[model samples]
Target: MGAAPSAGRRLGWKAGLSAGAALLIVGIAALARHRAGPPARCAPGMVALGPRCCGEGQRLDDAGRCAGAPSRCGAGLSAAPAGCVAPGATVRIAAGTLRLGPSDWEAQGVVEAREVFVPAFSLDAFEVTEQRYAACVAAGACAALPLRGEPGVPVTGVTLEESARYCAFAGGSLPSRNQLAFAAAGPSSRRYPWGDTGAVCRRVAFGLRAGPCGWGATGPELAGSRPDGAAVHADGRVFDLAGNVAEWAAPDRPGDGMSGTHGGSWTDEAASALRTWNRRLVPVSTRSPDLGFRCAYPP
Candidate 1:
């Protein structure tokens, strides 16, 4: 038989083994806890929300998982399938200067105002309507728009790529952020396209969840006369420059795969969102039910 260790030596060996075993157990427990956290529990294409999770471009479902589309679409744009069309021709805006940016009274943080010069260009008086886009689809020059909204409303739910295609089909192009601001705010650089009207529905085609399609009304009325009180562009060409539907702008920096959207939408109640200075930079692939665009032409 092997010789036994002395009692003192045996005690020391036993204690060392016990301490090592304790440390190993602690390490295993820590690893298990880490694997059980939210980052681990969530699946691919899902993000963990408070006590739940959501999918990309989707809100939290009742089951706490991301499912379905985003909750906010432009006001008046329904989940229904239909198209929209504006009834007016394009307007020509002469080359002019526009003072863009927030007013001194409204400036916060580092936001400042600047003057922008826009070349002579032609812009549509109204946002592109579903009917206009459909014509392009029929010609096989554009993709079919998703089934939502009405024919008389501003064409919502288009990506920047789609908007560019539509403009090209119409023999025009998308306006730059600076151009849009100039067309809306003019040289005075008013607080809003319609002055400081605050959050009034009359000044902007908003507040109604469903657009003016029902009850003998117009849908997203940009092509023609609105129910009075809507702001006209400072240059006196485009309509609903501050609200109605957000319009896509040409990318400020090309090759960056990024672009900007301007104006306020019907879903927004905040006056600031509808100002001439407001700009939302997003990916070109983005599509929203309340987002649409207008076309511009060089002089």
Candidate 2:
């Protein structure tokens, strides 16, 4: 009877050991499966933040906390005083011009331009491209403007009213004629943004190659193409104020049929025609292949 009891006790100990070994094997298999599985994919519109997800275009903002929704820029909010509102905001105009350049053949054709203070604002760095304008048209924010070729080309044939509507949608207003001139004039008065030196047309201006007399043919060039010649503000904003395309400025007052346009077009002379103070005006409804606009915003 004693031997039988001892043998039973030994069998019970073996059973306990086998159960413990099985549990250990199951745990190891689970761990291996977890490590061998594919990594989890990040969701669309969710920026990764270390092993977690965050909002698009948003970072930890130095506090290590996720930024809230309704993105600050989505509902008419600006990130910085002079920063871009959103990735695709339409340009806004902040002020108007008080005077215009002379049209006389002689007299250096100085515009005697006046200054109007523009608060920190935002503008479409690129002229309204065809693709952007098309989206506007589809959204019913603007009328469909004609296009010749690539949808990436700058949108032309848009009237002042149409342009203003686009800007308003993007949280901006049409620049007064004065504000337009101030941007073109830059901080100091010089013949052009790159100064009075007789630089190459491609460098200072955006037109085709000039002949011996320095007159060039007309062609559309990329916006902000003159990277080396761009004017950089203290805030690190680079602008193609003189070369990209001629932009329309807002009209002055009632019965002011003459709307101002700034910047020398791709076909303009590199010297006198591209002066910073140079200003010209045409009818508000006038549209040209080389004419486009950039917008400004309120401070």
Q: lDDT (CA) for every model shown?
A: 0.64, 0.53
Question: What is the C-alpha lDDT profile of model 1 across 1-299, one tens digit per residue?
Answer: 98889999999999999999999999999999987642232233333343222233444334322235533222222221221124546767777787654464665553456676788888887788777788899999998877333455577879998999989999999998887887777667766766655545445654334432112122233333232333354355467787678899999777798898988775564667777778888888888866899999876
| Candidate 2: stretches off by over 4 Å | 1-109, 113-118, 196-199, 209-218
Per-residue lDDT tens digits for candidate 2, residues 1-299, read 35455787899999999999999999999999998753332233334443223344555334333344413221222333221122344333333332234422322434453444555455555566555667777888887776643333356667777777777765676666556555544445444555545445434434343532223333344344343444444443334567546777777774676677777765664455566666687887887777777666765
Q: After superposition, how far is residue 116 of candidate 1 from its true place, in Å?
A: 2.0
Best by lDDT: 1
**Weakest ten-residue segment in model 2 by summed lDDT:** 75-84
- TM-score leader: 1
TM-score, every prediction: 0.64, 0.58
The collision pairs in model 1 are 55-66, 74-290, 76-211, 83-150, 83-151, 84-130, 84-131, 84-151, 84-152, 85-151
Predicted structure 2, TM vs. truth: 0.58
